[model samples]
Target: MVSTRTPGFSRPRGRFTGRTRTPAPTSAGPSSRPDRPRLGLISRDVPRQRRENTFPPTPDRLNPAHLASLRSVQLLGCAIAAGWAAAFPIISDLPNQRLWGAVAAPAYALAGLLCLILPRRFAARSAAAVGLLGAVLVPLALLALQGRHQSEVMVVERSAHLLLTTGSPYLQHPVVVTDYDPYLPAMTLFGMPRQLLGNGDALTRVAGDARIWFALTFLACLLASWRLLRPSRDRAPLLPLAVLTASPLIALALAVGGVDLPLIGVCCLAMALAERDRTVGAGLVLALACTLKWTAWPALPVAVLLLWRLYGRRPAARTGLIAVGVSLAVILPSALTRADALREQVVRFPLGLTAIRTPAGSPLPGKVLAGFGPTGHTVSLALMTMGGIGVAIWLLARPPVSAIAAADLLAAGLAIAFMLAPAGRFGYLALPVVLVIWPRMAARRWSGKPPVPPGPVGRRPRPERPEPALPRG
Candidate 1:
């Protein structure tokens, strides 16, 4: 190994260089800014100038008080989410995320409200779990049973059936969102149980619901991933199941549909694996995610670079080769089976390059620009593509050797992609949101020990000798 430090952790270091300009005196800044804690990111030490210039981070977003507070946040978030979820049915061309969230939201809010009302810490965590079943899970099960859910659930199920009967999951011509099988071949796995069981009775329908499967897969992968991440001596308790289950985005996804959830969970597992120097294990897990969607492909290279930095070339090489081979093994066959369908559905439809565009129009920067005209759409795509390329270049030049840094980099890159894609939605933001939050939640799981700082892997950063001039990228 390159350094004695555990594979999973890296010492936090700020990247500040000496030549950076000084900022105005802290005394002159806004009254509220003085007490605001600056969130540290990256491997190098931040200069005092940069620290002084930074804005106050959001309390709910990055620095919550505790797991109990997270439950409160979840419930309170659900309460406010009513406005957002209710708007989906009224505003969107399709009721995809749906009115179900409208119902689930308040239920979570009530859970949070109860905790706030009770004035006990344990009440918050314990009640939140009850809230999850009552507020979200019950509704989800009912929706699945009644077949009153988003079209994506059925789309995945149909794709699985097709994959079983035919060789590929996509259709020859898909004119609607439901018809388009934008997900890659591995996604068919989630729908297989439903296809085999057939929607005969309420029991089977609820049991075999693809949404249920998606939720299960997500929870399983998440628990397994975090278990790998926690230190052996310190057994940090995971973010409460109640809080995670009742979380606004998570609950909404469970109620409506979330093939993306499983993919995110698996990717988290892969990152955790890589952090522990389970080189081949990380690659295989990531490959499963990569085969689910093109969005997950970025994680592969990040994992490779991390392995190379810590475990050396041969392990990284093995991982890279295994991941690439596994992905191709599934992808190439599916593509060859229905080349035209795959191109039209997976590639064109998702990029908004097709005649029938996706319903993922959240009026985000990418979609707003795309709404202008073909030129605007092209510009949106180009910008998104550039964002991706820029991140790739940065990863190559300053590859993160630590798990948290890699996750942060991945989160930032994904956020840029979701923001700049010609077809994007609010729900897609959950990918980055979870990626950033998961690490912090993990760190804070133990009661007494201070949270682990993210930074450069292997060893403490050596003091830098002043350069003649900073080397150009």
Candidate 2:
């Protein structure tokens, strides 16, 4: 330079002499600096671009081994369900029992074989198709062939007729030959459309069978539950979905036309909605379920606990009030019109000393207690109540953190209640047990994560995080 330095430059001095001179600002703006480079938006995004491409997208298809195992289980379940439906004719006093068995056994066997051999997607669809056909056709065929209907269906149909004719479903029917309508007024309402058009003939009643309604509704619930419980990481939850949809108990319920299927379906839907945080919808559906039967009662407390954990006490209380209000709205008119009848038939009769006598052959605690007479009934009732209460407490104390967990907790509670119940059906445990266990089995085969070790109840799990790297010298 003439002085070899710009106006504000300073040369290094003393021990810093080996270092370059410090640069200073000239008349030129900061951009004129030679040592500094400007970073544009594109340059700044380079690291982020690399991060975005660091890992490949997760696979959409399930592991083949897992799929095979799941398919095997599904085929086995479908075979059992089909066999059960087909054998119904032989087991019961129905016309063409052997013929029906012959037809149904082969159809189900062929469907199961098809599912076993087809590709996974097609297999799932075929299994679902077979299940739907079985649910609808088997029950209708039974209704056509059998002389007597399931006791609950008979009672419901009779109640609907009574409601249409005399405006009091709770009143005993003269011609329908049912002992009593043990269901809530809501059930009679469900049967009214068909009853109104019918001349009270078995054919017309069968045409608008309440079991069909229950079966269809149950299928809808399965679809909704499958959608909700689907894992975020997995694209296809085919295995669990098939297990749930084609459950033998569900098929049996559809065939027999039991009132429990509708209640179970509603309860499952409510749980799914609640898990999705659709509080209002959940409350309304839960209220509707409560109106159908007492089997859904335990879900009320569980729903409340879930809402309380997710939204806090106030919202939970409000949702609870909404559920109670809806239930009262649906039930009160009938309650007011026939308080004595409703109380005696819906409440007292089900809990009556003789209720367990119908299923005396069952191996449950209640069934076993039936042989001991009134004292045993009383003890069974107390134990059942205590068991239900204990399960409720356990759920409230720890509250499930996810939908699957909620289903498991709810299923456990219902199972305990049913097992100890004075008049519980073993069939009542089927859907709940399946909902609780199927996912666990599927998860063990499909999930890549390590299994969580069992911990004490009410303990919150801590998340594991990686340690920070130390700076190098």
Candidate 3:
């Protein structure tokens, strides 16, 4: 028949047909070809850093809401940084703050502007990274190397020394604001590293700086809260968290002082834990925060209200009992042992009643009023008291049933207190601002998802009805 199998390789009759043989795959060692999938063995040859960084998920790019959120954060952050940069030279004479404002802050603003102005959506993440590096990491490194930090660092470290030597953290009589340890006893723990490490070298000095400990505490609590809010193993909102940390509200104080950071962070953690119904954990965390600073005390009642409004009396009782009990146990012994000293440093000094003038030179209304001698001081205190009464009434009138409501209420109270305090820095306001923002951001509820608003006490909230789809013709 006309050679039906006409092709060249017609299995050369008897020569090649005894048995059919299959050819083996080409010896392309695992992942040798660029198109081939990497095997476990092939991954070994890749650089550790390269392998880890390679193929990172670009979820933000895919999600428009998330990308828009990132841009908004960057834009807001840049504006704040620029404002700080321009104002520092005029308002603050502190060397560290001045240096950071001149160098780091401008760099941060520039990076953010460039990133935002670019047409590329992918630039958002790169911009956040760059901003963080320029605004926080680099400046922090410089400060540590130069052994130049805010006076609060010295005060904290000195308190640690006193704690070791005399079982108390404050001086008997203080000559200046810096001489007084204007913090609770628990704050002394951050200073322990410096006392133990002995600032012998640059590295040691950096390691010994109390700011490092303060930063670590804040970062730890923040990460914990993030985890508690989002339980997925891989769902760490690290990028947003980093951006928040690098924002002017945090980075400026963090670079120079950051004494309040640990307290702020722990308080946030307590709220997150309580929201999840982990009463014991929440109580303990709140107790830690209360011990760290008096500012954190307001958070306790707010948290208690949140628990009570949500789960009922049992959970609220458990959290309040643990928080109040543990914090008292920590505070009372020290308060009793060194009553006069603690009063001078912790109470009178902060209220601007001390002989030594407060170094807090902010032109805020409270500070301005307090600067005008005794009458002004009394007026500021009275106003502050009235503010507190107002907030307390509001708290009782409408208890928060949701985490967002709780946070907002607490932040409002703190902001009022800070603004009305006889002796307070402009920097202190960061705590309130951060409290309002960080919790929502950590939960990933801001910008993308709306948080549940507080409902009537003892009544279940109505479920949200989904919007009807658009009808097609």
Candidate 4:
């Protein structure tokens, strides 16, 4: 060895040869390792890679001025909605007057400011709870203002009395008992809850009953919001929840006992159940929603989509079964008790009415758009119907099983289209429509990564070959 050749050079190592031999890698399968290097941030202990992925190339995560602008817009909407709600109180003849109107305006303004200042830092559930608490106390405040003897429920008492005592739901004259409207029977049946509460003056009893229903509606919406906003076990971020809960339109809707509140809860529950593969539960919740309001029928496509996804391509039969069951559950008892009454009230009443007035026209953007034409209701409804059909098709065409984001978009879009409906009552339209849309809009904004390019199904990515080990010298 000392003669010149090195120890290993003297004789080739095991499995190697001196005559231009090439080495093979020891491992057969591809390396189970990431292609990229990880970079970590020292001070914060936060991984730089995740932070970079979430934030765009822009220097600021969220521009403070942009957030302030959003807040300002929301405050303006709150003011307008509060003013509208205060100036004209429909549903019940209760008057809000300027004092309560002022209360709502400032309350909403402050609430909106809070939302603005916090950005993504705010606890939305807590804020929504606070808002709901304020809404519940509104009735008590109104009771105190109007005196216990003069309640909003009492306003409708005379009409309620005629139905309760004589099996009729309406009065022929101010207080005269008559069977002019058959629909009164069903209304009478539903109104029984109020009658059971107490025997007070007509206005007091009627107002009290309405108040109770309204309160229940408010509570339902509040709870629904809380549930929707709760942190999921997956630890997925909830930007959608924040956007929805913080929306000014939703806040305004909660200010009054808006009918859409219960509908929102029902729809949310239905979607949640459907997402969990609880078909029957979803159907029943949707049916309950239908009984509360006819507008809930718009969610039929979503229900059908869920059914199809659960049962595969041959889903029509299953969907039909669910539909028949839910329909029977919702309509059977009501039809039996008040078939004639419903016909008279819903059908004949519209024919008899010479005018359809909004009390005051709706403040929502949809109303404004429809107002361009004389037959706003027809036009608005047409647009909504068309949009709904389109959305249904799209949703069904590509049913998402694990992706809540896709499902939420479909539901929320439908809700917005409904608000754009020309005939929607102001109390009914604005809030629910906005809540659904806000989440989707925010999600689109927050998702920093670009959408993935579509690839052929089942195509496997090819491995990149390693560079030839530089020819050893």
Instruction: Using TM-score, give the best candidate's number.
Output: 3
Query: Model 3 over residues 1-473: C-alpha lDDT tens digits?
Result: 23333344333222111123222222335663453222321135555544443332224444323654666755776777778776776777788988778766677777668767875665667767877788788888899988899898889998899999998898887776688877898888999999999989998999999999999999988888877755233567677677778777788888899998988788778878878799999999988888887888899999998889889999999999999999899889889999999888888888888888776688788898987888999999999889988998998998876666777888888888888888978888887887777776555444322333222222222323333444444
At residue 27, what lDDT does model 3 achieve?
32
- What is candidate 1's lDDT per residue for 1-473, written digit by digit as tens? 23434342233224422223223222224883664333333223645444443322224344443434655555555566545555555655545355565565556556556765665756565566655775577778767767877777788899899988877798887766779988889999989999888889888888888888888888887787667754332343443545676676787777878777897788777877887789778888988988989889889988888888878998888889999999999999878878898888888887898888876558689989999999999999999989999998988898876666677778889999999999887788888877776755554332212234333322333433332343335
Each prediction's whole-model lDDT (CA): 0.71, 0.62, 0.76, 0.45
> What does candidate 3 score on TM?
0.78
lDDT of 2 by residue, 1-473 (tens): 13434343343221111123333323345665664323211133345434222222123244433544477766876678677757766665644334445445655676788788999778866766666555546545665445344677767877888777877788742233256566887788567656655636666656676666666666566556655644333355554555454455654555655567767667767766775677788888889888888777777877777777766887678768889999999889888888877876787666654232343245778767745878988888889888877887888678865555666778888888777777776677875865565444433323322233222212222323323434444
| Candidate 4 total steric clashes | 13
What total of clashing residue pairs does each candidate reach?
8, 1, 0, 13
Q: What lDDT is obtained when candidate 3 is compared to the true structure?
A: 0.76
Better of 2 and 3 by lDDT: 3
Off by over 4 Å in 3: 1-73, 117-121, 231-234, 446-473
**Each prediction's TM-score versus the true structure:** 0.77, 0.70, 0.78, 0.56
Candidate 4 local accuracy as lDDT? 0.45
Summing lDDT over every window of 10 consecutive residues in candidate 1, give the lowest-scoring window. 19-28
lDDT, model 3, position 472: 46
Clashes of 3: 0
